[model samples]
Target: MVTSGRTRAVKLDSIAAGAVDLAREAAEETAGVLGVGEYLGAYAEAERVVSHHFACPHPGYRGWHWSVTLVRASRARVATVDEVVLLPGDDALTAQEWVPWADRVEPGDVGPGMLMPSPDNDPRLEPGYTGGESAADPEPAEASVIRAVVSELGLGRERVLTVEGRDEAAERWLAGPGGPDNQLSKAAPATCITCGFFVRLRGGLGREFGVCANAYSPSDAQVVSIDHGCGAHSSVPEPERAKELPPPVWDTIAWDETGGLFD
Candidate 1:
């Protein structure tokens, strides 16, 4: 036996010498009780109590081990088995490490009753507006004065209507189906700007977008760009209805007999 800093350490050799045979016999008895195959041998170790290792017999469970622990009573000469457990050996099959439920979430897995809270420091949105006190507000007193004057003159906020915004909107319109690139617009005789059914909007946007009032047009009642066109332009003439030709005058009667009668 070996002695450590504060407590006595039971020597592994001594435990193996004493418990190995006992553990093998116990393992045999357990195998019989469990209706399993016999264990090969008992391998002993000295912990607080002595533990014995035995190889498992089940063919499906490779590299798994069965362990039986033995503890000594205060005055006892021999150690008695504390418990038996099935444990995993170094090469035994086992489940993966457990993961948190939140970490396992995937896209589209959120359903009703699932509430995902946004992070406090979201990058997409700005903090609430605090008038001039907001750090995001522009500096320059002249700039603020110009904005105020524009608002007083009935011009909307820069966010609502800006030259840059108008340019972007114009680009989008020019690239969309309502633009001159469309097949209908390509064949149209005139653009929407000159169409009688085109009702212009109010504000700066009015210069570009207008409502199509032609009931028979594909874009009827829809907002179209000023340059947009369609086959149903108001200036296009209606097709003339075909007139019925006069029935052929059949000179039925005796035109030939009349020649002889007149003679």
Candidate 2:
């Protein structure tokens, strides 16, 4: 958030010294026993408004303090308590700044039956040639003719992916399991670019990515990079075939050299 760019001066009231005990009593009462600790300091907000700080003794509220604001009416020497509340200190343990559910959502967080609405001004998408989904009625004859011409040129979509969106998708695909860096690709027989089941994607992504049409591939039906591969590559090597020969004749004719049957 942007700063105010202006500063205001505060006048310290001498009466703050007289009301220190009163502010402490207010803070103690608001915090009850075991909440408030030793006195810290006091500061002035206006002519007769002052606030006193006391360390918070609760273990869960580390680096937090009790702030008791005191106010005085005209000609009154004694100040009465206005408000008492707990405030964080400079080095306090605090939670991260809150983020909207839409902004914090990650990929796959929206499952089936979930609808995550996209903001109209999202940077990832830009208006098509027709300027996308206007609530106004159809335009004049000349404008309709122009729109028809644009539609004939294949620009009929309401919104198109911006350069940032394209780049984001490309990077995500390249880092996923179907990318060249994954274990399957590292030990693959060959890359998908030369595989028979590799179906090249169209448009700007055609040169770098394709769909895996191989049923046996782990990444089947998924987008894979040009260099990504698996054992199911079309031209995997075949095992060596065993050789065959004619059956050999028995050496019965030479068996007489061995003599007796027992032998």
Candidate 3:
């Protein structure tokens, strides 16, 4: 038993060291490859992830660039290094060396409008945007649109709005525009088109925001973000939570008649 315990401790130590090593390597790589502007942009994206995950005041980093390293050196012998170059302000590390937004959406931000399938870029995003959008796609229209899609198609018996509102929103959009007449081709085209929400619920893609089971990948709708309950916002939601997401700003996308989603 004691021998086993020592072995475990040794393994743990290796993993911890590996994590540090991975972070350091990524930081170096980031510094080497990116210019100031590019690094700042990457940092901004990383900051969002960090802020959302930590939910604390910025802790500050030693340099403008930072990276996340995950090393499983013992059992699986796996090592992962994520490089993130931050701008000149705000640090996001905890005393425990944790960056909360590492895997979550930034606390109070929307999607980033980037393309997908390039290099960890979210595939679900439309071709117009630049960076990977955030993971949360909360919108009021999501509820109605998703419901309409599902009701129209008669796909699964799953009910919308059980626990979290996100699920319902996702389901409804997956159903598509026709309500029930148009059969969802291979994947939910209209609903699955957006990338941020895709990662929020469905798993990540090996190449882009690959195949989502969500009904229709709806095109990006314009969602407004005005101060609710403010003087000029009387036209906003009565219940506050029921406010619709700003309509998508991009042009309306046509229904995919070709059958395949990405096609």
**Candidate number with the higher TM-score (2 or 3):** 2
Model 3: per-residue Cα lDDT at residue 61: 43
For candidate 1, write residues 1-263 as lDDT tens digits: 87667966555545434676777666667765433345545444554367777787776667777677777665567778777777788899988999977577775688999887544443433333223333235687766775576556665322243456567767776687766678888789999999999999877778888889999999888778888899889899989999998666885653563456558
Candidate 1's error at 86, in angstroms? 24
lDDT of 1 at 117: 57
By summed lDDT, which 10 consecutive residues of candidate 3 come out lowest?
223-232
Considering lDDT, where higher is better, how would the candidates rank from best to worst? 2, 1, 3
Stretches of candidate 2 exceeding 4 Å from the true structure: 1-14, 32-34, 45-48, 72-75, 126-158, 181-187, 241-263
Model 2 clash pairs?
A: none
Clash count per candidate: 0, 0, 42
- Candidate with better TM-score, 1 vs 2: 2
lDDT of 3 by residue, 1-263 (tens): 34553422122334334344445555555555442222221111221121101011223343343334343323555444433434333543435546555344443355488432223333322232111222123355555555555446543242322233444434443343312224332233233323333322222211122232223333223211110011112122355467677767874764645757776
- How accurate locally is residue 112 in candidate 3, as Cα lDDT from 0 to 100? 80
lDDT of 2 by residue, 1-263 (tens): 99997877676667864677888788878887657899888888787888889999888889999998888887987788889999999989999999988879998898989998768998889977762444123766666766677677667677888989888889999999989998899999889999999999977887899999988889999999999999999998787898896566875545555658787
User: Each prediction's TM-score against the native?
Assistant: 0.36, 0.67, 0.17
User: What lDDT score is found at residue 176 in candidate 2?
Assistant: 95
Off by over 4 Å in 1: 1-159, 251-263
lDDT-wise, the better of 1 and 2 is 2
| lDDT at residue 248 of model 3 (Cα atoms) | 77
Question: Model 3 off-target regions past 4 Å?
Answer: 1-13, 33-65, 71-74, 83-263
Better of 1 and 3 by TM-score: 1
